[model samples]
Target chain A: MKLVVHMGVLLGVGLGLGLADMALRPLAESAENATDINDLIGQTDPDSGTPANTEPDVDTPEIRDPVDDGTGNTEPVDDGTSDNTEPVVDTPPDVPVVTSEPEFPRTTPGPNWPAHHVTVEQASQLFGRPDVLFVDARALDKFEEGHVQGAICLPLEAFHGQQPQILEFHTSMDFPIVVIYCGGGDCEESDAVRDLLMPDGYENVYVMHDGWPGWVKMGLPGETGQGEFEGFYDW
Target chain B: MGDKDSCSAGCGMTRWIALPVRVALGGVFVFAAFNKLFITNGPALFNKSIHAFKLDEYGMTEGMMTLSTHLVPWVELVAGLALILGFWLRAAATITGAMLVVFIAMYASVLLRDLNVECGCFGKLSPFCPKTVGSCHILQNATMLLMAGLLAWWGRSAISVDGMLAGKAKAPADAA
Candidate 1:
């Protein structure tokens, strides 16, 4: 009878303490903000039947500069600013004018295309690089089904809870680049993950523009099941 | 008189031997609770760890997961303190022993399913076991279970709160 009383007291105390802790430390706002996975997956582009890039193209130059008509008249054009005292001049004979676009296309700030979004081709180039880390933002079941050869799974819904682990792994590896991807076609999970990671001092986080489907479609290295922690401690 | 003396001597020896075992078991539980409850974002990390076991696949709801996440470490804390103070050694040992059994079973399930999940036994401070679940966890928990069983069977030592209280209770009975 004494043993039973002791057990009951311990249980009651534990329950009280647990409830107090829960009440004190509320769940993070991220949990409340997490979008339903089904809702995200069901969304599609009506026009192209692809993931709609509804977010405004912040990468595009909004204001175009007036082109110089090449009159070579040494006159300061009345640019709106009083600080513009010097006249615009053509390039000197010694200087060369290079007019080539960058090797890879840049993405605009949007749900489908994060500012640092990398194309499937670019991601392929960085695949074997030691400085790059791949993170799969898909659900665990999807990740277990198949994922990028060395990607770690960190689903969007679980990001708030699981971020410490990801941060620890990333910091330990000191990977310069982190490329996150989710299901292809209308999936913003990857972008959502990138947004969450940015505030944590990760400036080099990138999202794979075409996501998992694009990687598989390209016949890139993909594997099923979770990969063992390759270089770092298994934790 | 000789037989009585010998039995008393045996009981004294048992209590002395059980002291360290009780303390060690209590200390481990306290440390485990500290890691799970006091570390930065500890509860959240623990919640994730529990989810990795995929209890939802067995029909566990999100609410149940959250409740367990909150409840477990506190229970560890209470039971560990009780054992360490020797206020209720048998009861504390019983609770901790039961917990160890559940832990061993969980580890076994993980291995059987071939699931690649972190043990999360000590949060970010796993010293004895590796990060991943394996046979070693079972061994470690089994060892703790033995310690708990010993405490439950042996009861309290003379150098304990329970011992003092028992002595005080017996004094009045002897006078009567």
Candidate 2:
């Protein structure tokens, strides 16, 4: 009967699975063992300061998705100020939303919005141009922690309940080109700002993928805290 | 010697396969949904796995992903409940057969793409990713496919309402 044939097939499949699992079990065990032992593969060398007994950080560094849509990303974000001083980027507890890299084939790729995310060199040109206006999308506090020099810090949250405020900020609409960058290539803060600005008729908004980290990695100028950058930090 | 008409439609034969098929596939859904409801970070982990694949790069939207979160569980729950009670056996079998076909296709595509990603299916046994391209998930679905096909082929035989209804219909003939 057909039912009998089906059982027969399922049985064959089960046996094959069992055999495969048995053959692979030892290899699987060894692989896990190696991963457990080698997680700190580089850290334990005598000169390396990593504590040998300490477990490696559970948070794996985000790797580039192999199927990258060509936009560069996964930057170590910082307030524009981190020098050689702070090497490890700590996971900030308060901010739950990480910036998203601008996905291409963007549902609506319109201009007068944050340009499709660009690389370091592309961002540098925009930042260096006198006609360009950069908006830092991190919160005021985060901006204080680090921010690009000459960029205005206008936290995206400002548009939370108030649509009017975003318009007021963009009152100068046409002249200087507006670009927003949040936490570098890994974040999407810049994109949201662009979307908001687009509908508000701000005409031109851009998200810098090589955002905070992009600027930092290139050794560009930035300041920390409510210092000389004060006026621009809250824009 | 040949009552060809009864066998031609296959109504009698299909009923036989439905019982086991419903139970097995329904069990998978029941198991899947129960864990989804109970696990502390089930949705997050599953969503993370989805992102981990960069499916968005392939045009899967956030809305689509969110839709799956709710839709998958509901289908599993409803199908499972009906399957357990042997209620609506025909509808359950047909839908389940369709879903399994989709699963097989997805697995095939993953294999074709050589994507080494967790399938995020059975959530509990699904390995923490950076998983290898070669996966057993395709085989798992193939088995489910057979079950679905078998059930669809035999609508009522094992332990189903279809059989009960057929039996009731035949009772009058026996009485005569």
Candidate 3:
């Protein structure tokens, strides 16, 4: 009976203190206005000469006049001269304006997506910028095998153990634009890492929707090796 | 009365041995709880650590996670203090033993699933085991479980609060 009473008391005290702590803590920041993608969309980098937003140009079909050769045969022909061709529809079928953007289809977030979801093109634009910091949220093996050129590996599972390293890196910057990525399809590691960082006052975090596979597929710069702080072996 | 007599009889040597074990176990718990509760953004970071276990896939909701985030360190704190002060050694040992069992099970699960997760056992300070989950963590928790078991089996120790209280309660009965 005394053992039961002691157990009850300990549990009751723990629960009471827990409730009090929860009530005292401030509510987490909401997803409203969390994404800064809109602000980033139209901005152009002067040095790179690449426009941040590369929404594909809509193709206009060429309108050719039918020519009659007096044999009652009307044929639409290429005139080989610019006189009959519409100037606006002169883009060659073989060459596209935005060659940097890959043709492969990539997953995109829905309308109500909370995190700042960036496509591979946008991520490529942000890449190598002094203000941007890429974080890989995959396991250590995957990160060491291949990852974005300068991305630091902060696997979602190891975040707590690496908190000091993370804080030191974050504080070393003046609020850098952090982009976190994981394995492309259906991986939530990037979002999970972002969530962990956000509560610690990292506001500029974004998720690469298509992830590392997309980056690699687009022929973006990447490197293979262990990251600086990912010294703990997964095995 | 019976408990005090047993402590004074053949169990005298065992009580002395259990003292250091109880104190050491309590100290470890206290230190761990301190790291989890007092560090900067400790709770939030600990929450992320818990999420890494992917308990959501096991049907644990966000609400349950939040509750655990708040409850675990506090329990550790209270139980640890109780053990050190020897106010309720049996109860404290029972609580910590139960927790160690859970931790060993969690480590085993993580290993079996081949999930590459770091052990958030000591937050950012992993003194005993490697940060990543491995057999070392299971061994460490198992050792702690043994210490807790020893403390629980040998209820009260010499020079303890429980001993003092028991003596005081017995004094009036002797006068009667």
Best by TM-score: 3
Ranking 1 against 2 by DockQ, winner: 1
lDDT of 1 by residue, B61-118 (tens): 9988888888889999999888888878888999999999999998988899998777
**DockQ of candidate 2 (2 decimals):** 0.03
Rank by TM-score (best first): 3, 1, 2
What docking class should model 3 receive? acceptable
Winning candidate number (lDDT): 3
Segments of candidate 2 deviating more than 4 angstroms: A1-235, B1-18, B127-135, B161-176
How many clashing residue pairs appear in each of the predictions shown? 0, 20, 0
Instruction: Return the lDDT, model 2, position B74.
Output: 49
lDDT of 2 by residue, A160-222 (tens): 654355556566545346667776534666777765554333333455555676555555577
TM-score of chain B of each: 0.91, 0.73, 0.93
Model 2 accuracy (lDDT, Cα): 0.52
Error of 1 at B122 (Å): 1.2
Show the lowest summed lDDT stretch of 10 residues, model 3 chain B: B1-10
Over A1-235, each residue of candidate 3 has an lDDT whose tens digit, in order, gives 7887997898778778878877776224332235455456456555543343444223223322122122322232221111111112233345423321122213233233455776666777778888788988888778888888988887877756666666566666664578898885457888888877764546678887667766765567888887555554443
Candidate 3 Cα deviation (angstroms), residue B132:
0.8
